[model samples]
Target: MVSENETIRRHEQDAFDSTHSQEERNEHGQFATPYDLARAMAEDLQSRVPSDSHVLEPSCGTGSFISALSALSDSFTITGVEKDSSLSETAQRLWANDSCNIVNADFFDYASSESEQFDAIISNPPYSRHHHLSQSEKRFYSQLAVSFSGVSLSGLAGLHAYFLLVGTGMLKTGGIGSWLIPSELFSVNYGEPIRKFLTQKVTLERIHFFDPENLQFDDALVTSCVTVIKREKPGDGARAVFTYGDFRSPRKTISIPLRELAALPKWQHLENYEERENHSGRVLGDYFKAKRGIATGGNSFFIKTRDEWHNEGIADEWLSPILPAPRSFHLSEVTSDASGWPQESDIALLNIPRTASYANLPTPVRKYLDGCPEKIRGSYILRHRSPWYSIGNTKSAPIVCTYMSRSDSTPFRFIRNKSDATITNAYLGLYPQTSMSEEELDSMCNMLNNIPSDVLINGGREYGGGLKKLEPRELMSLPLTSSPS
Candidate 1:
């Protein structure tokens, strides 16, 4: 029987997290669900699953779901599978008195067993990115996913995709399936299989997106969504509910037809389907060309603070003034002195010449290069460059748009760059492709600074923890309020 003492159980979870290293937890993509959220999800699952239903939890960590289900009803038989031996042992001990069974076995292996099926599958699967898995691991997961869903999983998919597909496959006909997976599945290219399976194979019931500003899990940085589906294949005119904000009381809800899902490049924005196209046709690219700042393979090694450079006796000629990260440089307008250094910040970029022989370079320059560690010098990005240390195209632009910021409050800041100092990849440099006057440039920056938050957020990708990022191409496609050209 599961422990009735909720406080004591929560204390055990805290102890378990303290015992595990951050690196170890990250590699395993192990993050426990908060009890409140688990309870809410369990309540929702209760509505879909039949009485006396058997529930399956894949990648169960510390038995959040088990505890939630036990509180709801004692009749529902629950099975939790965890790959980690220690977590499974703890869960077994915690729920020893309960009717639930905890298994310490690889889920992929267990899921492949043809003999078992469940009335409901519910879990927050691992969010491990594909890059962490070895070639053999990727091949195994991909093959199993394809076998289960008949849709070829992309090599780039995270571990969450496999759980969704395999777990759904293990469901009884007309069984219910639900998952708390990364919102990336709604936006990234690799989510095709899950999206296809939901629309074409299973009936997508509803997808609830948590307000990014208020995350459900404490430490996990992933923006999450709760997706509910049924095992039955879709028929004509099937619709799925998309809700945003708090699950208890959603801020917005929209029902979209299943057939229309395949046409969308991404599904997260369905929460704002009504106002998604309220902007004008004219975009930033119509007047100015946006480009990402240069990549100095190793920013720390290639960029130096003003004090560090001056103390090293490196001549001003060997270094070019560069803007620091947006967080470090606060001014909306950058002005340079006669020496072309931004008066606000002292960071500078080194322009190590590849054409010149290393031996023939100035003593200070040679000393600086000698100080660089082997790892920085041999980094993949640097190794690919003709002269590993030389970062090219260090020219400054008139306008620099803040590349990323918090989604809820911080709108993208378009800084008027009145200086000759270049920017790093942290900011997008906007150059007037066509002729424009000084007044036009000023107006452009002002307009961008005042642009509605939705205009920028809809144009860019929202990363974990409410961070919205705009790449060069994504920024160019956004509608600009004013014409500066």
Candidate 2:
């Protein structure tokens, strides 16, 4: 009977989903949690808290967690906060007779007035990226993060991290929190704070990573996880539980000491890592030093085809040949033309060396520099540089790599660069370090391509649609066939 009602609620959620476009929801970070997944999380939390515990959902959209808890037991005192008026009203109306209170307010605002107030907090918080926030908002979230866990969260963190950590303060010392969030939180650089919060600030009971290929949310492209954390600090010799596959019937499980878990660079690295790490002491870092391609203050305004650059009356000295994004290239290997431009495209970066004098520049070049948009000129990357127009590090790469790939195709590709032309931020420049021979490099590239991308990229970042990102450092750590010294 409860299952039947949940189905109805899900249908109602779909009805509301039509009112707003996916882009709107993405900006608001308002993906609704599935009823079954919410129920599974609630069942875990339900076992930890007292029957009469007052539970809070910090970023509840349409009461998925409330419905889950209600189905489990009527004894749970349920309160959910939703910022969207339409969804908040719908949640309030649906659970009016079920003893659930749906508060239409921002979770951050609600959190400010409350602390140590709930026995359990079950939520699928907003996954809005950091860019959605204003500077003042970022400052507030960062400062609060430090206050909560003594862990300085990166400003690059998505909105979900703030909600996850802020809720920790609202819980009683032993309260349980079960959040349904994207798996990105376990591997991204910004996720370091979350790992620390779990192992240092609280006890992580279990974190179950759903198979990326079988995503839990049909509407979202991201792989999801059930992060179950207890409010109390980790105890001595505490072992955090790690699980994979379906929550009810996980395919694999591992328990690592909380102390040891905290030491790992990424929590997601626990997936088939040991079995895949079979290698001589050397990795790609031994043969090549991976450097990310240059970043322009604004790609569109600063980068243009040679024809486009010439038309603008800018001198060739102000332009440097650059490889376009990986999507633009059809072949794995990039070759150079007689003029040193990439054969694929005539794209060139606006190269103004730091040592170049702005006063002695040509009129056309000065006019071009002056024409830089205010937004681009004031960009974080540009403003930090000594000369706002200066963009160095444009050098030929011996070998390059495409960072991400679809699950159906190869996970990563190592492209041999046959060009003197450099690359943009689209690729990683793998410059030879150990005087690796050409045949050895070819063999190494073949070996990397042959290894299962999942095995090769284990412990790295993943995205929706089974897309995986190989960080510059991750590229260096990749196992290599080159003989170790």
Candidate 3:
């Protein structure tokens, strides 16, 4: 007869194998946590759990938590479950030499059936949304959340929130749990349910926000935070420790009173508290509607310099005065001619005409249009009554910023528009509402120009070839607007 622990491991492995195919795991964002991160999270929980307490790692990818528990001499019982079959098998193999109970079933389903309660729960659950869940699975998890937290999570919420909610149900009264979840929950709209659960359902102990500059996962691009909470009666004066930097060795730590955290509508406000204070005057959202520049399906095929157009006899109407990638433009004050065209600049805007206007095109331009490839002619731009060469209204905004930039260079730098050329969709257009004067705009531009490079580097996201993209949402969230008047 097999030992109890071995039997449990086999049962878990068999269940996993029966349920998940290899392709399904990859689609579900099923990357297992690194050993170091698992160990660190386990150690943090171990420090909080009483001796001999039962600990559950729901959605446990391959028993990293089990391995961590094995190292402890607290007489603790560990119950680990993984939904992915391959990972569950790997977990069983890694812990083959050890003694621990492992389950190879979906934790969401298991939690619904079982009434067993644990002294502690720890997990790095899946990050995918309801789209990954079957219709029935979504309904099950949705009902579970509504029953537990009284708040309905958005369908867009990742699978991890469900794990957190279900895991909360499996915990014995006064049991503490640590979750390795995305830092975005503290800030995103969909994360409100998770936040509400953390604030009201449990006594949140601490939140460790990792430095975005040093991301945790090689495959995942998101920032992460470790949330520790205990099941207890909701009470006032519950304080939460906020630590930033290395979890093993933090650089900055703040103990935020729970009252303050609950009072704020947005938790992202806490990430950069100092910046928030400095820019509390007025938000960019208060005065302007910020939008991304544009997204051409293929920039290489679409954007061309004036020389390239002239040498190839490409129709001027086929090009638009698109701002070169942020690197190419240096100045701030862009000037357009009386016709709103860039004055005497080699940078020509792509300007295709509508079908009605096409008949009026010059001979050279008409010939060029006729010579276009069949593939190009069939594109969405060409299919429209107006072709891709047709430019949108040339209305220039008072201010423009590079939408994408690298961290190593500068943070938020203003472009001095010395050139008579306009930008394409690679820039951010800042259109002022009816709120501020010209003097204020000039002052705002100067203030933005002087923003420290470090702040800019931290705020932007990276791309290949050292490229970085800054969305209006990210830019608007910055604390710069909070600066003292």
Candidate 4:
């Protein structure tokens, strides 16, 4: 049995989804907050706000927070601001009987124009990727951040950080704010500005990270966290509490002095970290030189399975054994057969020559090249090469690591490559440094295979839909906590 409110909310959501394409939602960085999460945040917020306090919800999509606010016994006035007009109207209709006002306007512009101080401001701000904003908008926000928070945010920081900074300006001194944001802020370089502001300009309170394995939003694949902050500067020797798991009752919590947090480059490292006396450590880059695999502009046209290659009569000389995509095999160690092909997988890349004599080539090979479409030939990767089909150089490396994965449990898989096979850009190849001898290859691979899951999560960046990605630089920067004998 569905309640009237739930049915109405579903219809409104359907209308919103139908009117806006996925691309539009992505561009605007709009995703409705889950009701359970909203209610939980509102419950936590109750203790912070004074009686009859005026509250503001920035970028409120259909007023999840407004609905949550109504559940409380406190008599408070709330203002919900949303950029999307239709969503604002829907929220307005839903909260008609409550002391809620919905404004359909850009939050940044509204925040700038307002002189009213809010007792509290809560939001699940848009996570707009920096690239999505035009140069002028980014520049404007970057400047405004410095003026408001005394921290000049990098252009690479997401729009959510800007919202946090701007919302702080609207809060009355000693007021609190709670934000639902991605966990990347603990690890990514771009989050430095927000970190600095929290340390210097405002009172850092608490952070609750949702268990990475259990995603908070079904539509979003990001590891989410709720951050609680106060507008007032911290007292001397102040500490911030960081918790992992459900906000209602976290799995673990750690208290760190604000001064120590300001010194750390990666906040995720704060978990279970103890300072070792006189212990020195090196990063993965000191042991290995990591490089991303070759990228063929078009995988569909150039990559072929074993049966497809055999059926097409592709010549052996023009084919190179290529490892299958990450999902195809589940082995930590890959071995090769007599033909130097990966025994666990059967895939080949159509490797063409830079200079070829068409008349002298086998009839089958020539026919295949003739069938190559203009689009494939003109692809960005191939167009620069002398022959469009000629692929970049590739060689087998002793170890490989997956660049991307959807599973938080195994976001990065290390592989011991006992095969003379090249990989696509989907993987990263790691070669031993000068100090690491070939004798240590087996030990190195074993160590990589056993790296703790938490270490991998802290070292990599997460995308929407809980996808984890690690660039060659980030992989190289991983701190090696264990050594091979």
By lDDT, who's the top model here? 1
Using alpha carbons, what is the TM-score of model 1? Answer: 0.86
Q: What are the RMSD figures for all models against the true structure?
A: 3.4, 4.4, 5.6, 3.8
Clashing pairs in model 1, backbone N/Cα/C closer than 3 A: 1-97, 1-98
Instruction: Give the per-residue Cα lDDT of candidate 1 at 315.
Output: 74
| Alpha carbon lDDT of each predicted model | 0.83, 0.80, 0.68, 0.80
Minimum summed lDDT over a 10-residue window in model 4 is located at: 271-280
Q: After superposition, how far is residue 201 of candidate 4 from its true place, in Å?
A: 2.9
TM-score of 2: 0.80
Residue pairs clashing in model 2 are 221-464
Per-residue alpha-carbon lDDT of model 1 for 226-323, expressed as tens digits? 99989999889999999988886888899888998867666776666755655566888888788889888888888898789878888777788888
Q: What is the lDDT of residue 292 in candidate 2?
A: 88
**How do the residues 1-485 of candidate 3 rate in per-residue lDDT, one tens digit apiece?**
32344345446545664577655654586655666777788888888889788888887776756766776553777777877677777776666443467788988777778778899988888877567778777788889877655668887777888777778777888899898887767665677777776777678898887766555665555667788888885688787788887887888877776667776545542555534434455556566666666544345555677788776676555666656676665666566666555553556655654543777867666776576667766776557634555545544566788766554556455653433355567677777767666667777777777766655544554432344455787667444644323
Question: Regarding lDDT, does 2 or 3 come out ahead?
Answer: 2
How well is each residue in 59-122 modelled by candidate 2, as lDDT tens digits? 8777888888888899988888988888888778777565678889988777776554888999
Put down candidate 4 lDDT per residue, 1-485, tens digits, no spaces: 43365457667877887788777877778878877888889888888788788899988888778777777744878989988888888888887555777888998888778889888888999978888999999988877667667778787888998898888888899999999988788778888778887888899899887766666766555678899999999999889999887788987888989988898766754567543223227778888899888888888888898678768887668788888888886788888899898998888888766566667777777788788888887777777765666675868887899978877577788888888888888899998876555457778877766667767766777665556788888898777666655
Better of 2 and 4 by TM-score: 4
Give the least accurate 10-residue stretch of model 3, judged by summed lDDT. 458-467
* Greater-TM-score candidate between 2 and 3: 2
Please estimate how well model 1 matches the true structure, expressed as its whole-model Cα lDDT: 0.83
TM-score of each: 0.86, 0.80, 0.79, 0.84
Candidate 3's displacement at residue 440, Å, is 4.4
